[model samples]
Structures are given as C-alpha cells and as structure tokens.
Target: MEILKGIVLLLLVLVGFTMFSLKMPKGMKAMGALAGAATASFLVEAFHFYVGGDLFGITILRDLGAASGGMGGVAAATLVALALGSSPVYAVLIGCAVSGFGILPGFFAGYVLGFILPKMEEKIPDGIDLIAVIVIAAPLARLVAIGADPLVNATLINIGKIITQATAQSPTIMAIILGGVITVVATAPLSSMALTAMLGLTGLPMAIGALSVMGSSFMNAVFFHKIFKDKSTTIAVAVEPLTQADLISANPIPVYCTNFVGGAIAGLIVTHFGLINNAAGTATPIAGLMVMYGFNSPLKVTIAAALCAVAGLTIGFIGSLVFKNFKIKSVAEVRGTV
Candidate 1:
C-alpha cells in the first residue's frame, strides 16, 4: 500500500508538474528559477566544505542553509508567477505564502497560485490588497504545502527504497535501469542531484548513475557536434545538458535513443568492475570519474570511464546515421518555434 501510494504521488508530481510547465506560458522561466535557486540553496554546504566557517557549533550554518533553501523556492516561484503577469508585490507575498514545498513541488504550487492570485486580487476592493495577500494567500499557501510536501517526500523515499532493493537483488540489470533513468532525469528539467540526495544513492548504484549521465553527455556532444560547433559549448552541455534543454526536448528521439544505449553500457562497466561512488550529486563526468580515484586505482577509474565514453561514442555514431534521415532543425529554430 505504501509503495503504491508513493508511485501514484510520484506520477502525479512528475507528470502533472511536467505538463503544467510545458503547457503554461513562460513556464520554462519558472523552471529556470527553480534550478538556479536549488543550486544556490546548497551554498551553505559549499561554503562549509570550502571555507570552513563556524557559527554556534555549525548548527547555525545548517539552519541558515535550510532557511536559504526554503526562501530560494519562494523566490523561484515568485519570479515565474511574475513572469506570467501577476502583480509584483502580491506575487512576492503570495510566492512566499505558496512555496514552502521543495523546489519542484513549490514550482507547481506557485504556478497554480500565480494564475489564481490575479483573479483573487480582482475580486477584492481597493486599499486592502495587503490584507488579502497576508490573510488569504499566506495561510492558503501553507495549507497547500501541508498537504503537498509530505506527498512529495513520501514519493521520493519510496523511489529511493526501490533503487536500494534493485541494487541488492539484481545488480547489473538494476544498474542499467537506474543509470538510464537518472541520466534522463539529470538532463531533463527535473533534478537528478535532488533525486540522488533523496535516495542517498551511493556505492555501485551511484557509480552507474554517474557513468550513465556522463556517457549520455558524450553521446549528445558527438551526435550534435554540428550544432555545438565549438569545444566550450560541447563541454558545457556535457557537464550540464540543461543548457540545451530547448533543443534536446524539441528533438528528443536521437538524444534519448542514444542515451539509453550509452547508459546501459556505462552501467554494465560499473557493475562488472565494482566501481562505486562514496558521494552523491557528483554524477557529472569529471566529478563522477574523480570520486572513484581514491576508492579504486586511478588507472582503473580512468579506464572504466574511458570505456563508458567509448560506448557513448559508439551510440552517437549510430544516432548520427539515424539522424541523417531527418531534417535536423537548428537549435535556434527550435527555440524560436517554442
């Protein structure tokens, strides 16, 4: 029952949020805000790791980080809502009221309130907009959060458990499945880092996911070399494919078809060699490959990653052949049409 409920919530949050963003005007703007804010929210940990500052036994730092993460969600939602034509101050206030859920859920919640708030403001008399926002929007937002955030958390926890079980029961097959899924999620508007964090995915599963994501990046760079045109753009997209979400999402066939192949190959190598990642969110090529340096011999890690890249390259070659049949629209053209 619990697993079923979690799956249902996962589908709702994933599908519902995806459709809302794609269908709504300026929805991608909101998604951009969420991504930026989510990365920024990790500043506290980043600082502690690099700078090593202490306030009230470092617990203060954590509290500050939590606050920043929460506010980041609010700010992201506000930016999107305002872009959708909500009033400025009201948008901010309502954004604050509505977005206590984590980044993605907060985005969906904010999108809903963004449309509704304008209608609500219109119904009210003059001179009391502040009251309306504070009294109505604030609590209503909390009410939404109370119901929504728990569902999201529950769904994430269940997903994590499933991955854990898979790794234990059938390592190779699970590696391919999870690797491909995580790679797609990472490249998509969804948060792969956040998903891994929720799952606490580490060891072999983490290694597989990291390799798959990196391999997919290599495949993308190779398959779209003409569009990328330069080393810098290719590298950037490899590290983070969200940079080209518009193009990738617009023409998903080649990218996804190749990614599945690359991901499976990477997964196979990681499982066969017993490669593992002790850390989470270090799933990018360099970061993912480097994490294994200390655990295994540097030579071994490099070879494993290189093999994954080779596999990705193989698929990219196949994808290129497949893509020859299509018109192969320019990235700019896709962006313009969208």
Candidate 2:
C-alpha cells in the first residue's frame, strides 16, 4: 500500500509536471523552481553532518533541513505566481508565507493557488488585486498544506517500509524494479541521492541503486557513441546524463528502455553477490564502484562493476537492434551544446 502511494506521487511529479510544463510558461517556471528546490535540499542533505549540529538538544540542523525543504516549495510557488502576472514582491511574500507548512504540501498548495490566482487576477481591479490575492490565495494554499500533511507523512512511512520489505523479501525482483526506477529518477532533473536518502535506502539496496544508475549510464554511453561518436559526450553522459538533458530528452524512449534493461541486469548481479554500498554519492560509475570497494575486495568489486557495465552495453546494443523507432537528432536539433 505504501509502495503504491510512493509510486503514485512519483508519477504525479514526473507526468504531471512534464505535461503542465510543456503546455504553459508558468508550468516551465514551476519546474525550474522545483529543480532549484531539489538542488537546495540535496546540498543540505549531503552536508548535514558538518552543518547540522546538536547543541542543547535543539536539533538546529534538522530544522534547517525542514526549512530548506519548505524553501523549495516557496521557490516553486514564487515562480508560478510570477508567471501568473503577480508582482515580484507579492509572489515572493506569498510563497514564503504559504510554504511554512513543508515542501511537498507547500508545493501542492502553491501550485493549486498559483493556477487559480491567474484566472482571478484579470477580474479584480488593479489597486485591490494584490491584497485580494494575499487574502484569498495565501490561506487557501495553507489549507491545502494542512489537508495534505497526514497523507504525505503516511506516504513517506509506507514508502520506506515498502522498500525495506521488498529488499528483504524478494531481493532479485525488487532489484529489477527498484534499479530501473532509481536509474530513471537519477537521470532526471531530480537527485537520486536525495530520493534514496528520503526513502532510507541503504546497504544492499543502496548498492543496487548505485549500480543501476551506473548501468544506465553505461548503456547511454554505448547508444550515444553509436549516435554521435563523441567519446567526450559519452563519458559525460556516463557520469551524469542530465548534463545532456536536451539530447536525452529527445530520445527518452530508447534511453529509458535501455536503462531499465541495463539497470535490471546490474541489480541482479549485485544483489546475487550480496554487495552493498553504505555511503552517499554512489549512484554513479566510479563512485558506485568505489563504494563497493569499501565493503568488498577491490578486485572483486572492480570485476563486478565491469560486468555491470557489460550488462548495460549488451542490453543497450540489443535494444538498438530491436527498437527501430529511436530517433537520433543531429547536435543542432537539440539546440544545446554538450
């Protein structure tokens, strides 16, 4: 049940945001805000140990983490408000005011309110519009935040439990599914590290995730090499694919399908060998392989990582042969330079 909730939320963010952004200017800005928010959250999460400290049992760092999360919602709301023709000051103020609830809730509230406020903006007289927005939209958004709080908390708990249980009960199947999912998320604008951390994925599960991401990169490098013949671009994509979002987005069908195949293979291998990664930032090739070395023999881990790459390459090659629909655009078509 918890897993279902998590999957639903993931789909909402991925599909909902994508559909909206492609259709509206405000939606694009909202996505940008979300990306920015994810970055902020990732930084805070990645360095919590040094920046967050316990003094007098105050839990300052923890609060900072929460506040950072809220700021992401604030940023998203502010961008959407701006796109809705609200004044900069008004948008920022309302965003901060409503986002006090928390990140996920604040985002949904702001998104709902942002969407509504624009329609009403044209009806109100200019002099009173700002005040009306503040009075009406702010509280309504907060209400949404208040309403979603329980569901969000419950979803998080269920997601965590679902991941824990799946990894424990059916490691192989979970590896295939979770690996594909994690790789997909990692390649997107959002941070897989943050997602993994939020889901409390550690040990063997973490290893599976890390290797899966790397495997996707491996597949990408091969597919890209065949397309562009640029070793540099292939290497860059292997490290982190989002750097080439324009290119990757153009061929998402092939990229993702190949990634799923590669990642599932990697997941199977790592889980079968009982490999693990107990550290962050392992969701890439070098870092992920290094994480394995932290717990296992260097030679063994190196070989395993190599095999993971091979799996990705093999699957990717097969996908290229089978999927004739993969449309590769010339570098100029993507309109972005790598």
Candidate 3:
C-alpha cells in the first residue's frame, strides 16, 4: 500500500511537471534553469562536500561544497529569473533576497518576480523604478519563497519520506519502482537531479537514483546509436539526454521505455549489493558513480556499477531491436533544421 502510494505520488509530481512544461508560459526554459540550479548547488555539494570532505578529507573542497549546497535558493532564483528574461541586476537582487529559502521556493519567487519586475519598470518611472523594485520586488520575492516553502515541504518532502519508508519495508519493489521512474525522469524535462534533491532522497533510495541514472548513460548511448545511427546525436544523448531533449521528447516511447527497463535492472543489482549513497541529489551519471565510493566499499561499488552498466547495455540493445521498425524523428527533423 505504501509502495502504491509512493508510486502514485511520484507519478503525479512528474505529470504535474510535464503539464507545466507543456502548458505554462516559458515552462521548458524554466525547468532547464531549475536543472542548472540543481547542478550548481546539489551536485557540487554532493560530490565535493560529502565525498571530498567526508571521505577524502579535502577541507577546501568540502567548504566549497557546503557553500554551494546552501545556496540552492539563490541559484534557482537567479537562474530562473534570467531564463525568464529578467535583467541580471534584478535577477541577482531577487535571488540574494531569498537567501535562506529552499530551491522550490526560490524558483517560485524568481518565476513570479521575473514577470512582475518588467511590468513594474514599465508602470513606474525609470529612476523611481529601481527604488520601487528594491522596496517591492525584493521583499515580494522573499515573500513568495516563504509562501512556497510549506507547500514544497508538504508535497515533495513528504513524498520522499514515503519512498524512504517504502524502501525500508520492501527494498526489491521500491528498487524497481524508483529505479525505473527516476531513470525515465532523467530523460524528461523534470530532471531526476531536481526531483531527488527536492525530495531530499539519501541512503539506499539515493543510491538507486544515482546508479540507475549512471547506468542509463550506457543504455541511452547504445539505444541512440542504433536508432539514430548518428554519431553526434548518440554521443549527445549518452553524455546528457537533456542536451538533446527535443529529439528525445519527439521520440518518447522508445527512449522512455528503454530507460525504464534499464533502470529497473540496475536498481535490482544495487539492491542485491546493498550499495548506498549518502549524497542527496547525485542522480547523475558520472558524478553519481563517483559519489557511491564515498558510502560503500570501493571494490563492491565498482563491481555493482559494472553489473548495472551491463544490465543497461543489454536492455538498450534489446530495446533497439524491439523498436527498430518504429518511426523516429531525426535530429534535423526535431530541431527544424531540415
């Protein structure tokens, strides 16, 4: 029952993000900005602070990670505002104002103020507009962040808790569910990194997310190579699916279905090995693999990773064979270059 609830909740969140990207004004750009913010903050913190500081005894790197990790709100606000066409000065100002807020809150604040700042500038006189922005926009951005904090906690955080609990109770089931879902999300605009970070996932669940995604790198590479037969497109998808989001989004069935199968197999391997990742939001490919060494034995981590990669490659090959006859959009077609 808990497993079902967790799956439902995660799906709803993913669906909500998809709807936002499809329907909201400038939503895809906003999500991209959010992913960038997660990379700047959570990824750095996870790799440097948790792995470098905690495991490797690198004090400077640890400190750098700590600083970056705590600045999620600032990063999200600044980036999102910039993505939404806010001026650099106003974006940074609004971002700095929401210093202590979480990423989602900062995102909301930046998104709202991104639109409002322009209107204010137009309505108010030029010289006075700066003052008006300082007085109104800054405080208002903070206020929006404050308002969003509770909702984020109630939804994303609670969902994380439920997943954690479900993992504790039924590791195998949760492994398949989380592994597949998170991998699919990695290919989507929602971004597995942002999702795991927002949910504050750690321990085994985080491990599943990180390694499963890392495994997906191989899966995507093989699948894209076979399907597209384009060296550049295959390399791009292997390196980072988001870079070729247009291509992937245009051909979702094969890509997403392959990712789910590969991710599920990787998750089972992770469960069998009892590997763990303490770093939250390290649901990336290279970095995710690197962070696993911090929490588990080096040899064990290496072995598990190798197995996951094999699983991913096998699935990718099979998926390609299965979908070989399916119609697919080329890079030129998807990008409108043709």
Candidate 4:
C-alpha cells in the first residue's frame, strides 16, 4: 500500500510537471534552469563531498561540495529567474533573498519574481524600481520561498521516504518501478536529476536511479543510432538525452518504452548486488556511477555497472529490431535541415 501510494504520488508530480512544461508560460525554460541548478549543486555534492571527500579524504573538495549543496536554492532562483526573462540584477537579488531555502522553494520564488519584476520595471523609473525591488520584490521572493519550503518537505520528502521504505520491503518491485520511471524521466523535460533531488532519494532507491540512468546512456545511444542513423544525433543522445529532447519527445513510444525495458533490467542487476548510493540526488550517468564507489566496493560497483551496460546494449538492440517498422520523425525532419 505504501509503495502504491508512493508510485501514485510520484506519477502525479511527474505528470503535473509535464503539464506545466507543455502548457504553462516559460515552464520548459524554468524546468531547464532547474536541471542546471541540480547539476551545479547536487552533482557537485555527489562527486566532491561523497566520492572525493568521503572516499578519498579531500578536504577542500569536500568543503566545496558542502558549499555547492547549500547554495542549490540560490542557483535555482538565479538561473530560473534569468530563464524566465528577468534582468540579471533582479535575478541575483531574488536568489540572494532565497538563500536559505530549498531548490523548489527558490524556484517558486524566482518564478514569481520573474513575472512581477518585469511589470515593476515597466511602471517605475529605473532607480526607484531598484528601491521597490529591494523593499518589495526581495522580501516577497523570500516569503514565497518560505511558504513553499514546508509544502516541499511535507509532500516530496515524504513521498521519497515512502518509496525508499518500499524498496526496503520489496526491492525487486520497487527496482523495476523506480528504474523504469526515473530512466524515462531522464529523457523527458522534467529531468531525473531534478526529480530525485526534489524527492531526496538515497540508499538502494538512489542506486537504482543512478545505475539505471547510467545504463540508459548506452541504450539511448544504440537506439538513436538504429533509428536515426545519424552520427551526431546518436552521439548527442548518448552524451545527454536532453540535448536531443525534441527528437526524443517527438518519437516517444519507441524511446521511452525501450528505455523502460533497459532501465528495468539494469535495476534488477543493481538489486541483485544490493548496491547502495547515499548521495541524495546523483541520478546522473557519469556522476551516478562515480558516487556508487563512495558507498560500495569499487570492484562490486564496476561489475554491476558492466552488467548494466550489457543489459542496456542488449535491450537497445532488441528494441531497435522490434520497433524497426514504427514510423518516426527523422532528425532532418525535426530540425528542418531537409
């Protein structure tokens, strides 16, 4: 029951974000900024703090990681505000105001400021507008962040705990679900990194997310090669699915279904080895694998990673064959190069 509830809640969040990205104004830009913030903060923390600091005793790197992690909200607010078309000055101001908040709260604050600041700038004279922002916008941004913090903890954090507990109780089932879902998200605009960070996933669930996405690099590479037969497109997808997001989004069924299969297979392999990742938001390909070494044996992580690669390759090939006849939009078609 707990697992079911977690899955439902997770689905709702993903779907809601998807709808926002598709329907809301500047939503896709905001989400892209969020992904960048996650990479800047969470990925840095995973590599430096967990892998470098915990594993190799690098004090400077550890301190750097700690600082980066704590500044997630600031990064999110600034980047998101800029993405949403705020001036750089206003964006940084909003970010500073939301310094102590979580990423989601900062995102909310930035989003609100993005719209309001532009209107304020239009109505008020230049210097007076700056004063207005200092007195009103900055405080308002912090308040928005403060208001959002508790809700984020209540909903997203609790859902993460429920999902992690479900993994403890039924590793196999949770592995398949989380593996498939998170991998699919990697290819989507919502971004697996942002989702995992927001949910605060760690432990076996985090491991499943990390390695499964690592496996997907191979899967998407092979799948895109088979489908598009374009060297650039294939390479882009392998490096980062978001680079080819429009192409992937245009051909969702084959890409998403194939990723689900590959991710599920990788998840099973990870669960079999009882791998764990204590890093909360390292659900990325390279950093994901790197962080595993902090929590598990190096040899064991390497072995599991190799198996996942094989699984991804095998599924990618088989899926390519299965979907050979499916109609897909060519890179040329999507990019209007033809």
Ranking of all candidate structures by their lDDT, best first? 4, 3, 2, 1
Whole-model Cα lDDT per candidate? 0.65, 0.65, 0.91, 0.92
TM, every model: 0.70, 0.66, 0.97, 0.98
Q: Write the per-residue lDDT of candidate 4 for residues 1-338, one digit (tens) a residue.
A: 87788778888889889998889889999999999999989899999998889999999989988989998999999999999888999999999999989899999998888889889989999899999999999999999999999999998999899999988988898899999999999999888999999999999999999999999999988888998899998988887889999998899999999999999999999999999998887889999999999999999999999999999989999999999999999999999999
Encode model 1's per-residue lDDT on 1-338: one tens digit a residue: 44344334434545654675678676666666555544555333323321232322466555664566456457656765676667898777756776555554555566667777787778888778668878877677667656766775676656666666567667776767667766766667765654554455667877787778777777878877744345655676777888877667776766666676678778888888888775554456654564466456667778888888888887777878777677655655775743
lDDT of 1 at 97: 70
Cα-based lDDT at residue 183, candidate 1: 72
Clashing pairs in 1: none
lDDT (Cα, tens digit) per residue for candidate 3, span 26-77: 9988888999999999989988987898889999999999999999999999
Model 4's C-alpha root-mean-square deviation from the true structure amounts to 0.9
lDDT of 2 at 265: 84
- Model 2: per-residue Cα lDDT over 1-338, one tens digit each: 54454445555545654576677556655555554544555345323422342212237765764455446556655665665566677667667766655455655666677667766677889879888877887778778778876776676435655675667777776777777877876666555654564444567777888777777777877777776567777888877776777777776777777777778888888888788765443465554554566466667667777888888888877877766555677566677554
Whole-structure CA lDDT of model 4: 0.92
Clashes of each: 0, 0, 0, 0
lDDT of candidate model 2 versus the reference = 0.65
Which of candidates 3 and 4 reaches a greater TM-score? 4
Rank all candidate structures by their TM-score, best first, as comma-separated numbers: 4, 3, 1, 2
